[model samples]
Target: MSNDVEHAKRALRAELRERRQLLSDAQRETAAAAIGARLDALVDSIGARSISCFLSTTTEPGTRDFVARAAGRGIRVLLPITRADGLLDWAVATDDGEIAEGLHGLPEPTGEVLSPMAVNDVDLMIIPAAAVDRTGMRMGWGRGYFDKTIGSMQKCPPVYAVIYDSEVLDSLPREVHDQPVTGVVTPTQTLNLSQTRH
Candidate 1:
């Protein structure tokens, strides 16, 4: 990507992070509850048994409720383990209490380390996002973790980014390596994209 596009993404990320940080605890809790319901509906609608999902930071839309709910329902949930080289490995999240502060300062699950390609075994994927466009273009934290993971997959399940409703946009600056997502889940609804991918 050009310097200008990279710069624009940085500015947008900063703005969104700031906005998320400004949210009050009560607001965050309510949003998390609503999003958890939406996620449950999606899981039921798709009949997802095994899923690759993320553990969100306090500032972002909370996934604690959803993660716990999924596990309680006997759904297999996998959380990302950030590698030293910036790639990701996988671990099964049996309980939220088992998650501790892991690599790159994100909450990671405690379990047998699944290889990076383990994501390919899942029914669906849910990722964190700074924002995403209607076209399914996801603006991640600019780490390229998901970018590389998705790119390396020979056959990837549907990748969805979870964000607040206001963060979904009409478009975002793009680059060659920036992989668009399959859809986005927000407090209001899931915005499924019309793009085709494996």
Candidate 2:
């Protein structure tokens, strides 16, 4: 990666982190509810019986409600478990699943661990992002986990990044390894930012 792009990404991620930390409890609750509804609708629209979704951190937009509701509806939800090798493992999401802090302090499922290939079966993917540009370029939180996962898939599904409404920008700093999303789901709306997704 070029030094300029790396520096830009670092600065943007820090600003986004600070912004997320500043959200009030009430604001987070409202955003979580709205995000859950939007995600549910997105899943239904795509008719995805199996999907991969990230367990959100406290500062990020919450997906716990959607994960619970999706599991309740009998949809197979795969939660990510980060690996030390800079990859992500997989676990099935359940209403009563135990969550433990995984690598990088991210929430992870404490169930039977599946290989990274488990994600290949998912019909859709909902991931976390600091911001996404109008063209579907996703700026993640400095970790290349999602980017590597998507890039390694033989048949990648429609990947959507969930972020706050204000995080949608006209453009963003891009690197060769930064993966683009098919769309974005915010508290208010869902936007399909790319036409290349199959």
Candidate 3:
């Protein structure tokens, strides 16, 4: 990653963070409901019995509704628990799963921890992103956890990043380690941006 590209990503992330912060509580709820519906449809279309998803922070597009609904439908939902070594451990998402502030103050499941390789069986992955470009290149929130996970998977599934509709851009700064997703799920629609789904 060149210094210029790194600088650009940092600036863009800061701006996007501010934009998310500006959204009112009502706006967040409406967007969360819309996004959850779209995600449910996506899962049905893919016929994914098991999937990996991230618990959204307050500023991010809410995914708790989708997670809870998915678990209720008997679709095994795995939530990522961030590891100290910059990797993610998996935990099954339960309707009554307790959430605790983990490393970096992110929400994590307080259940029996599974290994990082626990994500291998997931049929799909729904991850977080600062933004994603039209080409599917995801600009994560300066953390390489998702990038590393996607890159390391031997039989990676269709990975989708959830963001606001406005966060889907024409282009974004990409580094060599930055991984592209198969699609993006926004409040209004789900866009499949890559042909590489497996």
Candidate 4:
């Protein structure tokens, strides 16, 4: 990526993050609950037994409730453990337990490490993104972790990036390496991109 492109991406990320931080605590909680309910409906509609999902951070769309509810309902939810090389390792998500601190200040589950390619076994994948365009291209935080992870999957499943409703965009500063997602799930609806080759 060119320096100008990288700069643009960083600027966008900062702007979107700032917007997310502006949401009040009560508003964030209510939006999270609604997203969780919609997610549950998506899970049921697809009958996804095993899913690869991310653990949400403080300012992002909250995934704690959704992760727990899915687990409680017997869905095999897997959380990513960020590796130093920018690839992610998979582990079963548990509702109760002290989460281990992973790279990028993300908290991960303390469980057995599955192969990085374990994503191929999942029926669905829900990841995080700062913004996504109409063409399914996701402009994530600078690292490109999810892009790398998804690009390597031999047989990828339906992938969705969870974000606040306002994060959806008509276009973003995209790159060739930026992996496009199958759809994007927001507080209100799921935007499925039609050309999901994976």
lDDT of each: 0.88, 0.93, 0.94, 0.87
Model 4, C-alpha of 184: deviation from truth (Å) = 1.1
Minimum summed lDDT over a 10-residue window in model 1 is located at 95-104
**Model 3, span 1-198: residue lDDT tens:** 499999999999999999999999999999999999999999999999999998999999999989999999999999998888999998999988689998989998888889999999999999999999999999998979999999999999999999999999999998998999999999999999978644
Q: Write the per-residue lDDT of candidate 1 for residues 1-198, one digit (tens) a residue.
A: 499999999999999999999999999998999888888888888899999899889998989879988988899998899998978999888864487789678888888899898888888889998999888888889889998898888988888889999899899988888888899889888889838766
1-198 per-residue lDDT for model 4 (tens digits): 577788999899989989998999998998889888888888888899999888788898988889988988889999999898888889988767348788778878888999788788999999999998988989888887899988898888888889888898889887888999988888889889738656
Q: Which pairs of residues clash in candidate 3, taking residues 3 or more apart in a chain or in different chains?
A: none
Error of 3 at 147 (Å): 0.2
Segments in model 2 whose C-alpha atoms lie over 4 Å from true places:
none
**Which residue pairs in candidate 1 have backbone atoms (N, alpha carbon, C) closer than 3 angstroms, thus clashing?**
none
Model 4 clash pairs are none
Off by over 4 Å in 3: none
Report the C-alpha lDDT of model 2 over 65-121, residue by residue, as the tens digit: 899899989999999999989899999999886799998988999889999999999
